[model samples]
Target: MEESGNAIGFLENKTILITGSTGFLAKILLEKILRIQPNVKKLYLLLRATDETTAMQRFCNEVMGKDLFKVLKKKWGANLDRFISEKVSVVSSDISVSDMGLEDSTLVEEIKHNVQIIINLAATTKFNERYDVALGTNTLGAKHVVNFAKQCPNFKLLVHVSTAYISGEKEGFILETPHKLGESLNGTEGLNIEIEQKIIEQRLKQLKANGASEKDVTIAMKDLGIQRANQHGWPNTYVFTKAMGEMLINDLKHNLPLIIIRPTIVTSTYKEPFSGWIEGMRTIDNFIVGYAKGKLTFIPCDTNSIIDMIPADMVVNTIIATMMMHKLQPPYQTTIYHIGSSTRNPIKPGDLLRFTCQYFIKKPWFNGDGNAIKVKEITTFNNFASFHRYITIRYLIFLKVLELVNKASCNCLEDKYNDLKRKLNWVMRQVQLYRPYLFFNARKPKLSFRVILAKSLDLMTPT
Candidate 1:
């Protein structure tokens, strides 16, 4: 797996189709390609919209409109629009549906004939997503993407972006291995996709028959996802569905050139397109934001536990390099690449906490009252039980007092009580979703041959 040719050279005059164009990593990938390879033939973006016009609007507002594209905008300046218009095409499509929900036959035919690469990045990333939705988007959506790729006669490669957490909450050195169709991590029998779909349909019908409210339905669906995931030995719905998606792709992709990239805890950009650029709260970013705003004061996590993280730019680079390598030397079988820092440059939760404290001490965040919030060392609980006990003693008792006070005041403090209750529920939910990672016992993933080759070529860097 020697890197013989330049990645830039490989992209020249190549037409590529990218799904999830509005997502975080997808935007970074799009930016890198357009900025570095102006000569690339075409970039067809599949967006979820009612029509092409709406899709283009989403592309402008969500994708190019992001700060990630600032560097490219600065470089292209006045010619930016023109360059984009010539090189990029936005199509209205939904991966959750068959044929990616593409109704325009002309556009579909055009893509089938000209597109040489299809990168599937669309996914439902919620830890406790609805079973039906997660199944449709992450699992069945993968099948749809593969079916679409089959129509492209000249398709050189299909890069499926997935999470490394798809390995679930297993303890040990996780490997870059492909999942087999209908396989369950716990060795549970009868893990059929068709059966799962049927179960979802049956549950929905029952809910409808019982006149379940929307809220009830949502809660039931989320609970079902968690139940099914746990039954199959996964910790959450997102990873469970994603793992199924990989299985489907691996099984369906008979002769197609495919690469599955599992990136772990993707953080802010490290170098390319500028550093420290991040959008929305993602994984650890939530903690960072919560801490900075003086909202997060304590956490239940082992300070010594390794928190695998990789920069957005590095992940993008690995994707590009992997694409290039696959094109140059297509493998006989599908390749899996784990893009993470746990193995090479691991950082502990304590290290991150210390860094956050030091940074905030120097430049404190000012609240709405224009007062600089004083920084303090975060309280860490070694395990969930201790944290639960603390929450019960500290917050629950106070909540009970608030309830009594509200009753005495004749609903005068009702809003405050309700708000506090909601916040506590949110906190509990968040802790449940994040508990697996906080106490994860798995060693770093064993890098695959391709990842090793890419790193050796200096195409990917951990720092």
Candidate 2:
């Protein structure tokens, strides 16, 4: 199939507000819009002010500093940076704030006068974040954006970035669907959002009163988010709060023309803007690293379980293409689009493991051992316990006798066993710390955000 440009004149001369402009998906989307729809009037980036002069510095250091925009730099030369700086202005903002962290009259007027579109991607993508931060960044942040969108004079589309795993506590065909979350999430969909905010404030105040370090406070908040997720039936704070955000967006953005693009497990770019432009790897990369380390031996996963893997580039292309179609067809607004690879392309975890093994044999980036981690499939029962039992009875016990000789001889296999035990203990502890959401089930609250996905699919037939 021929790859066609997804963005048309849809963005021409239009002022767009893009949140999460520094993130993986946002990077691709921003680059595509800039490169494809270069004439888009102004691009307002809403990012938190890390320090003084935050917006421009963040735009340069965060967004344009990466390798993803290298092509844009080379092609446009000096004009590219200038274009981004001039046409693309930054607003030091926070999604957790009442007005998306943009309270300045000038910036507010800039948005009301010039901005025509709002794309909210700013979020705490950390799966194990604090409940308040997750809620603030994910749920309430969207609310702030919606509220801001309501204030815009000539607002067009308010695109929300939601995850595909919003439907918690249920599992099945996992259709392109949604959930009616009235109170199940927080013991009473009526579980006052205001109360939670107040509690967060109180907790933070206590932290400050105790003179807690910023790092300590952050850690405590993350632990709280994880604890909250456990209290609820979801995986972790990220998806849980994202679920709440989806529900709130559905409830709050009633009058606004909005579409939620729910993409699943965004990976490296498969094409466009730049192919395979990946940096820090997270979910899939961990799998690759484990396979390379020869440690992820026995995985307990549903092999037929259809792992939905969509390339970030494809997702971005689909997102832009959807916007174009939506511009042409207005009713496509207020829908949730699952830009997941569940439709056509599917590569399972086992498949990924095998591929990593093969790839590593060819080009190895191994650990400090100087010896590559050997990859071999061990039986399910043979992970650590049963194998340990057999080895303990047969080999470890024998080695115990030999250890006396080995201490006499140094470098004994018995000593190796002890070292391995210590290492495995450490690994298990780290894994447990991150394991609040190994098995998660949440449904889409509604396709209210999916109109863009349908429109894009109709335009490009990606699946």
Candidate 3:
């Protein structure tokens, strides 16, 4: 990461186990820690693979090969292999599976002897995941990992990457603490885990008994997640399950040395291994895509609403800082840190939308016409007409025009348009799955907006 120097705290000669190593946050953390400390004993990256070969393939193709590490590559020169072999390692695993999917005895023994610090970044961030599926991944998966953590003889700290929305509905100021299950993040009563789990399991069983295949069951479950969201005022299964998982962990943390980092919305790096080196699908990327296609003319966010976000590198730095601090701090409550720039670097979604729209106008995305799509300024309206118009103008109009071209010239553009429509619909369905959180009329303003705005403006503007 592009920092002034090292840091106030560091993880030197520490063995760490990381879940979700293939995840966005994990990749940054792994890269930064290894680069900064250089002396950290070893890193055990848990992958959702069956064995070493599959895990290694994922590590190379997804992790090491990314453009984000180009700066470090220059520094390490040809000694990268020796560095990776001596310090970094990968272990095939998944939280949803028992024992973190690490069934390999030799690997387990190696971990038992080496890894002492555990960073669990594995999470199903898709807001629309099914309850059963979410529980399997978010709740049960957490339990499995923590159970594994408990078994670690030399374990010192466990930092769980949780969302700030764990606070749920009632919003004013969300303090950092364990939001125990059956207790809401805002102090409102929440669903009991046992009851919620039983209900989901029963529904799944009914679907199975009806001769539903695995795919059929998944579809059924996804629908159930949507229904659950509607009932609970949440948008999807992802947040619901994560909230539940946080509660369970808070309830069960007991005497465990743990910390929960509740990051609001994570965006691209401000300064890292390199500037503007963005990768993967994220909220910012989605906004960019919408801007490219001329589907997002206006943002449906509060002008003063806080789109709390922190850079990936900053969050990683905070993770290492918190871990290092806990190692030096005395035992007490589970440390909960809100790692968001909304306090010191708030950037409105509307402003972001404006900036993106303007950027794309000069360097526009072209189709066959080599002309950008036309769009008018839009307003925030929850009515069906607003959504219907968007679908019609942005998607339907484009497809209809393609079909017209196909008919006039007898071209294969018709099939292409149909495929594009299918892809767009899939994305919309996923968005609708997490509608509650995104569309929730909650604007947390406990953090200062002016300072954050000033900093963001400075970053957006050139040096």
lDDT of 3 by residue, 1-463 (tens): 3232224224667789999888888988887776667877788888788888999999989999998777667778899878888887877887887788888788788797777878889987766566687888888777777778777778778888888776665455666656555654333454567777788889988997899998888888888876764455444577667777777776666677988887877877777765655566775577567657754444333445556777777667677666655654567458777767655567765676667656766677876788766544434445445766777897788888888888887776877877777766755653454344444433334232333233333333211
Give the per-residue lDDT digits (tens) of candidate 1, residues 339-440: 888877899999999999999989999988999988799889998889989999989999999999999999899999997787677667678888889888
lDDT of 2 by residue, 127-193 (tens): 7777677888898997888888888878878888888866554554455544454455446444445
Which segments of candidate 1 are over 4 A away from where they belong?
A: 1-4, 328-331, 409-422, 449-463
The better-scoring model by TM-score among 1 and 3 is 1
- Listed in order, each prediction's TM-score against the native is 0.94, 0.81, 0.82
The Cα local distance difference test for each model comes to 0.87, 0.68, 0.69
Model 3: what TM-score?
Answer: 0.82
The deviation in Å at residue 104 for candidate 3 is 2.4
lDDT of 2 at 59: 75
- Candidate achieving higher lDDT, 1 or 3: 1
Candidate 2 lowest-lDDT run of ten: 436-445
Clashes of 1: 0
